[model samples]
Target: MSDSDEKPEHQKENGEINGEEEIRLKPFQPWYSVQIKGASKNGEVVMFQITTVKLEQCKEEVEVDRQYEDFEWLQHCLNIVPNVKGVIFPPLPDRPIVSAAEAEAKSRKQLGTASKNIKGDEFHKDCRKLEKYLQGIVRHEAIGKCEALSNFLTKKEPPVRAKLKKGILSNLSRAVDGVRKGGHKDIDEMFQKERDLANDMQKIAKETSLNFDTMVNSLCRISMACNHLSTALCLGMSAEDNGASAIINKLQVEFAKSIDHYGYAVDVCTANDENTLGFHLDLYSRYWLSCKEMLFERTCALVQFDNASKTLEKAKPLKKPMAEAAKEDAEKELNAISEVAKKEITKFHQQRTLDFQKSLILYAEAKVKAARDVYALLAKDVSTIKQMDVEFD
Candidate 1:
C-alpha cells in the first residue's frame, strides 16, 4: 500500500513487488557438454568434428559440429572485446608446428608402424584442452556475459570482433609527452622489475619443459632396450635342466615389469608438470604483463593529472578568454580518472601477489612428488634385481 511496497513499472512483467528496480540477479550457472564426434578428411586438410550442447531451461539444446580452425577463429574473435581487456584469454592448444610429412615420418619412426589417422593421443589431449577453454570462457564474469561468446557457441558464422584503440587514454602526442614529464619513478621501477621476472620465469618454464621431454624419451628408450634384451635372452637359451632358463625368465619378467611401471610414473609426472607448472606460468606471464601495462597507464594518468593541475594554476594569471575555466574542468576530470587508475594499480598488484604465491607452492609440491615417485620406482627395481641372485659390476 505504501510507496516502499509498490513495485516499479518495469518489474511488472517479471511478477515482482519490490519498490526498487527489482533486478533479477540469477546465479552463475551454465553448462556445455563437448563430444568429439569423429575425424574426417576435408580435401588436403584433416578436421575433427566437435559437438557442443547447451543444457539450460528455455534455451535451445543445440548441436553444432566445428573444425579445429573454427575454434581457433572463435578464440581470436573473443579476445578482441574491450570489456574483457584485462583478462587473460585462455591459450589454445599448440597446433603441430612440424610439417605433415615430417610428423608422419616421426610417428612412423616412434611407433614402428605407418600412420593411419590423425586422431591419436595428441588429438584427444587437444580436444580436452579445447573443452576446458570453452568452459572457462563461459564461466568468466566479464567474458561470459559478452554476446560475442554466445554467438560463437550457437551461430554458424564467426562472431563480430571489435578492436580497442591503443595509446594512453587517447591523449595527443604533445599531451602524452607533457604527462610523461611528471611520471612517477618508484612505481615505474617496481613494475619493470616484475615484468622482467615474469619473462625470466616463462623462459625457465619453456626450457624445463624441453628437459622433461628429453628425460621421458630417454626413459622410454631404456625401457624398450631392456624389453628387447629380455626377449633375446629368453629365445637364445636351450637348457636340458630348465633351471638356468627358468631363473633367467623370471628375472627378465621382473625387470621388464619394473621398467614399464617406472616409465608410466614418469609419463604421469611429465604431464603433471606441464599442466600445473607450465600452464600456470604461461597464464601468469600474460596476467602480470597486463598488470604492468595497467601500471604504466596509471603512471600516465597521474602525470596527466599533475600536468593539468599545473596548467590550471598557470592560467589563473593569464589574460585569456575561457582558458582558465577550461583548464579547471580538465583538471577535475583528469583527477577523477587518475584516482581510478591508481586504485586499479594497487588492486592488481595485491591480487597477483597472492595468486602467484599460492600457485608456486602447488607447483613445488608437484615437483617434489615427481622426484619421490622416481626414487621409489628405482628403489623397487634395485630390490628386485638383488632378489634375482644376479651379480652386477
Candidate 2:
C-alpha cells in the first residue's frame, strides 16, 4: 500500500493501480518475417504469402500451393533452432556422361554381333544370288562368242550353231536353277555335273575340228563360271564359320582343296594344244584375273564383316556381366575417364590387327598367282620354241 507498490502506467488498469500488488511488463522479443520467392509456369515471378511459424516446427509442415512451384518457408522459431541454425541445401549429384568413343565402341560391338549373325544367314543366299547372276552372264557371253567362233570355224552352219547354243543354254539354266534353290548337297556333286558337261563339250569339239573354236570358247566360259562358284561357296563357308557355325573351318579346307584341283585341271586343259592354250590363257587373263581381284575385295569385305561380328559376339557376353560389375564397382568407386579411354583404344587396336591379317592373306594370294603366271608363260614359250625346232628338223 506504499508508493513502492504502485503499478507502472502501462501495466495499470483504468489509469489506476490496483492496491494489491504492482504488475511488471515483460520486454518485447524481436520476430523475423520471411518472404519466399518462386517462379510460375508461365515464366512469371510469383511472390508467396509471408508465413510466420517457429523454425523448429517447419519441417514437412510447409505446404506449397502449386505442385510445380518453387518455394521454401522458414519460420523464426525453426531458423533459430539449434540444429537448424546452420542448415544448408545441397545440389543434386551430376549424372555420368558416356564419352563418344565409348558409345561408338559399344555400338560397333553390338552391330558386329548382329551383322555376324545376319551375314551368316545371308552368305548362302548371297552366294546363290551371285552364282545365278554369274551363270547368266557367263552363258550369255559364251553363247555370243561361240556363235562368232562357230561362224569362223564351222563355215557358219546354222544346225551346228543351233545345237551349240541349245546345249550351252540348257546346261547353264540347270546350273543356275540348282544354285538358286540351294539344291547342291555337296561340292562333289556340283563338280561332277560340271566335269561331265565339260567332257561332253570337249568330245563334240574333237569330233569336228570345224567346231573346235566354239568348243574351246565354251570350255573357257564354263571353267570361269565354276571358279566363281567355288569362290562364292568358300566365302559363304567362311562367313558361316565366323558366325560361330561349326562348318566354317571344314568348308574352308574342303574348298581350298577343291580350288587346287580346279587349278590343276585348268592347267592341264591349257597344256593340251596351242588353240586350247590360247583360249585358256586369254580367259585367265580376263575373267580369272578379274575374279581373283574380286575375290580379294570380297575377302576384305567379309573380313570386315566377320571382325565386326566377332567383336559384337565377344561384347555380348560382357555386356550384362561387365555392366553389372562396372555398376557395382562404380558404386564403390566412380569410373575414371582414363579407364574408359583405355578400353576403347584397346578394342580399336584389336580390330585393326585383325583387318591387317586378312589383308595380308589376300595380298599373298595375289602375289602367288602372279608368280605362277610368270613361270607358266616362260614354260609355254620354251615349249613352243622346242616344238618349232622339232618341226624344222
Candidate 3:
C-alpha cells in the first residue's frame, strides 16, 4: 500500500484532510507506601508485620508478617529472576549478636524460667532492624522495580516457584531417553557416579553460601567495632591525641570499602551459587529417574522376547503350526521393542554426557571467581593495615 493512501483520513479546519494521530500507551510504573505496623515474638524468634500501600489510583493495600529469614528469602528469590539480572539489592542485617549473659537469659526464657514476651529494649532493637531493612530496599533501584519484591511487600501469598528455562535441559533430554532403552549397566553406574559428584558439589555450594553469609556479617561487626574504637580514641585523647583519630578514621574507611565489596559479592557470587545448585539438583533428579525407568523398560522387553523364543522352540514340528506361528510373531515384536529401547538408552547417555560436561565447566568457573574475589578482599585489607601501621608510628 502507498504511504499516503494507507493513512486514515481526518477532517481539519479549512476543509483539509490530515492523517490520524498515533496513540501511545505508557508502561506501568509502580510505587509502594510502606510502614512497620508492629511485631510479634516467640521465645527466640521475632516477626515484624508490614503494611504496604501501592500508590496507584487503585491504592491497593497489603499486610504481611515476616521474620529475618523471610526477608533473606525475599532477596534470594529476586536474585534468580532473569529479567532483573543486573539489579543489585541492598544487604540484609546480620544475625543479632547475643553475649554470654544474653544467651543465659534466652535459655532461661526458653525453659519457662522467664517471661516469653520480648523485652522492651530488645523489641526496640528489632524495630530498628526492620526500619533499616525497609529503608534500604525501598531506595534500591533494582529491588524497588522488582515485581516479586512488590508482591512480597504488598501480598500474603506463597512464593512463586522459579521455572528453569527449557534450554537448561535441552541438551540432555534425548540422551536421557536413550539411556532408558539400551538397559546398559555401565551407563547406570556412570550416572550414579555423576549424581554422587553433583551431590558433593551441592554440599560444597551450601557450605560456601554459609561462609559468605558469615563474611558479610563479620565485616559488619568489624566495621562497627572500628567505629567504636575511633570514638574511644577521640574521647580518651581529647584534643591532643597526636594523629590517632585520623588513623582510626582512615582504617574505618578502608574497612567500609571492604564491607561494600563483600556485600556486593554476596549478592553476586553467593546468590549465583544458590541458584546453580538448585538447577543442577533438579536436573540430576530428572536424569536419575529417566535412566531408572528406561532400564526397567529394556529389561522387561528382553524378558518377554526370551519367553517367546523359548515357546517357539518347544512347539512340535507339524502338530500345531498355528501355535508356532503365534510364538514367532510374539518373539519378533518383543525383539524389535528391545532393539528400540537399546537405541534410546544410547541416545540419552550421549546427551547426558554433554550436559554433565557443561555443568562441570560452570561449576569450575564459579569456584575460580569466588576464590579470586576472596583473594582480592584479603589483599586490600592487608594493604590498608600496612598504611595504618605507618600512621601509628
Please list the C-alpha lDDT of all candidates, in the order they appear: 0.57, 0.35, 0.55
- Each candidate's number of clashing pairs is 0, 6, 11
Give residue 313's lDDT in candidate 1 (0 to 100). Answer: 60
What RMSD, rounded to one decimal, does every model reach? 8.6, 42.0, 17.1
Considering lDDT, which of the candidate structures 1 and 2 is the better prediction for this target?
1
Residue-wise C-alpha lDDT for candidate 2, range 1-393, written one tens digit per residue: 656666554567644555333343332221212222232222232222222222334421232222111111111222233321112111111111134444455433433433221111112222222222222222331121222322221231222212113378898975665354333222234333433433354444334433444444444444555566767766666444333354455545455555545555553453343233332222222332222222222223333444444555566664756655544543322123223323433443364356446545654564467557656765654554444322211
Compute each candidate's TM-score over C-alphas.
Answer: 0.55, 0.17, 0.34
Report the C-alpha lDDT of model 3 over 1-393, residue by residue, as the tens digit. 676764544223323412222112332344777777777776566767888777764787888876666676776776665534222233355555335467557544433344343322345445555565565566544456577677678667646544534484785875675555434332235444534554455465446555644554344344444445545544444343357766665666566566555555544554454345433444444444534544444445445555666766776777467666766776665555445544444555575577657766786788689778867986887787776664464
Best by lDDT: 1
Best by TM-score: 1
Assess candidate 3 and give its lDDT: 0.55
Name the weakest run of 10 consecutive residues (lDDT summed) in model 1: 111-120
CA lDDT, candidate 3, residue 211: 63
Residue-wise lDDT of candidate 1 within 1-393, one digit each (tens)? 766566664467555545234444554565554555555555545455556566663545555556666666666666676644334455566553235675676545443454343323355555555665676577655566566666767776544444435476666864665456424553346445644554465566556655654554454455455556656656655454356656666676676667566666656665675666555555555555444454454446545566665666666455334666666665665455445544544655575578668767876888788889878987888887886764433
lDDT rank order = 1, 3, 2
